[model samples]
Target: MSISGINNYNYQNYYAGARHNMAKTGGEIRGVLSSTSSASSNITLHMSDVGNSGNALTAMGFPDGTSASVFQADDYNPADPEYRVRYWDKEGNYTDTMVKVNDIDPQNASYLEMLAYTSYSDVEGLTKNAFGDFMNAARGVNGNISYDADNIKEKKDYMSMVKELMQLQYDSNNLPGYLSYKELYDYMNDKING
Candidate 1:
C-alpha cells in the first residue's frame, strides 16, 4: 500500500523546514479556498456556488462559469500526505479535475496560475516502470521490495519528462506571468522531489 516518490521521512524533514521558512517569512495562510472546511465539504460547497463570490472555481483562477468536479474514489484518503491533483481540459466542456488539500499562501497569486498552467497529472499515468510492475506482479514477482537504483532512476526520468513537457507548454506562452521557465521548472521539481 505504498507509493513511490513519496517518502514520509523526507516529507517530515521538508515540512519542518518549510514551516520554519514560513515562520521567518511571516506565517501566511495557504489553500485555494477561503473556508477552512474539509475537502468533501468543499466539494459540496463549490458545487453549489458556481458563478458566485468566493467559489472554488474563482479561487482556482477560473472564470465565473468554470466548474470543478471531484471523483471520490472508494479508497480516497484526504489525509494522505502524498495527495496531489490531476486535472485537464475536456475540450469545450468543463475542466476534468480532482482535488488536493495543501496549504499555500493565497497572497502568492501565481500559485493558482501555476496550478492552472500545469493542468495535467503530476505523474504521467501508466508509465513504463509502472507497467513493468504490473508485468512483474503477473509473473508472481514479489512487489514488496524494489531496487533503490531503479526507483531513483524512475523518479529522475519522470521528473525529466514533466520538465520537458512543461517547458514546451511554456514556450507556447502557457506559463503564468510570475515565473520564468527556469523558475517554474525548479519550483515543480522541488515540489515533487524536494
Candidate 2:
C-alpha cells in the first residue's frame, strides 16, 4: 500500500502490515517500501523470523519503543478543502487546527511549515508538445527500417530542452551546505558504476 500527500510518500507503515501477515503465515515476505518518496523519507523493512516479541521488534529491524505509524492529520490550509484537519473539541464543537507538518508527519521532524503543491496531469501544457514529439519519434523509429523526419525541429527542440535542464541544474547551485548537482551526480554514478 502507498499513500501520497503533497510531496510526501509514506511507506514505512507498509512493513508493519507485512509483518503481521508474515506472523500469520509463518514465513518471511520481501517488499519494496516505496517506488518514490522525498529524499529523506524513512524506509522500513520488517521480518518475523523468530516470531513476535520484543525480539521481533529488533528482528524486524526497528529499535526498541519504535511506534507504528498512524494516520496523520492533514496539513492546515484555509483555502484547500482537504488541507485543514477538523476536530471536535472536548466541548463537542468542531474547529479547524493549525498543525505544523511535523506534528503529524514523521518525516518532517523539524516541524517545517506545511507545504503546498500543484499536481499536473501527465500531459501538462508544457509537456503536450513533448508528448506529440514522443509519438512522432516512436512511430518513426520502428524496427529494421530507418526513416528520417521531414522536420527535425521537434528533435532539435527536445535536445535543447535537455540541455536547458542540465544547465539549470548546474546554475541553481544547491541547497545550503548540500551537494551541488555535479557532486551529487558524479557521486551517484561512482557508487552505482563502481
Candidate 3:
C-alpha cells in the first residue's frame, strides 16, 4: 500500500506524514520529497554502498578506485614486515616489487595500509637489491646470512693446501626455477651482503 500516486504534494504536514509512513515500513525513499510552503526542498542523496572492494567502488563513480587514501599515503617502511606491494612487469627480466622501509605502527596498521608503486623500472636493480636484503635478512643485527664450509667452492690452491676440503656441489640443474632461482638468488644475496 504505497501513497505514491499523488505527485501534487501541496502541504507541509501531509508530506511529512508520507515520509514518516515510508520510514516505518523499512523501504528506502530516494529522490525528492518536498513541501510547497518552503523554498527549500527535501532532497535525499546517497552513495552506492561500496563494501570495501576496489572494483565495486570503481563502479560507483570512483575512477578505477584509484582515489587518494591514507593507505596510498604510507611511506616506505623497511621495518614493517606485514606490508607488501606487487606489480606485474613482464617487460623486465625481474618480477617488480616495491618495499616500503619502516616499521608500521601496530595500533594503526589496517588491511588497507601503506601505498607502493611497482612501475619504477629505473630502480629494478635497486629494488632487487632491497628484496635480496629482505629474503636474506641482511638488514639488521639479528640476521647474518652465511655459507657453511660444505656450501663454499674450494679454490685450486686452497684445495691443494687442504686436501680434506672437498665439497659436493648442490645439483639444482634439474630443479624448477622456483626452487633453483630462489636458492641461487639467496646465495647471491649472501655473497653480496657478506
Q: Residue-wise lDDT of candidate 1 within 43-132, one digit each (tens)? A: 221322233222222222122223232233234454542222222222324433333423321123122222322332222331222222
What ranges in model 1 sit over 4 Å off? Answer: 1-53, 57-98, 101-162, 165-179
Per-residue lDDT tens digits for candidate 3, residues 76-189, read 333342223322122212121233423322123221221221111113333333222222222122233232223212212211111111111113232232342343344334
C-alpha displacement of 90 in model 2, angstroms? 55
Q: State the number of backbone clashes in model 2.
A: 0
lDDT of 2 by residue, 43-93 (tens): 343322221111111111112212111112333243332222232222334
- lDDT of candidates 1 onward, in order: 0.32, 0.26, 0.26
Off by over 4 Å in 2: 1-29, 33-154, 174-194
Candidate 3, after superposition: displacement of residue 32 in Å?
Answer: 47
Model 1: worst 10 consecutive residues (lDDT sum) = 147-156
Q: What is the C-alpha RMSD of each candidate to the true structure, in Å?
A: 19.5, 22.3, 25.6
Superposed by TM-score, candidate 2 places the C-alpha of residue 17 at a distance from the truth, in angstroms, of 13
lDDT of 3: 0.26
Among all candidates shown, the one with the greatest TM-score: 1
- Higher lDDT: candidate 1 or 3? 1
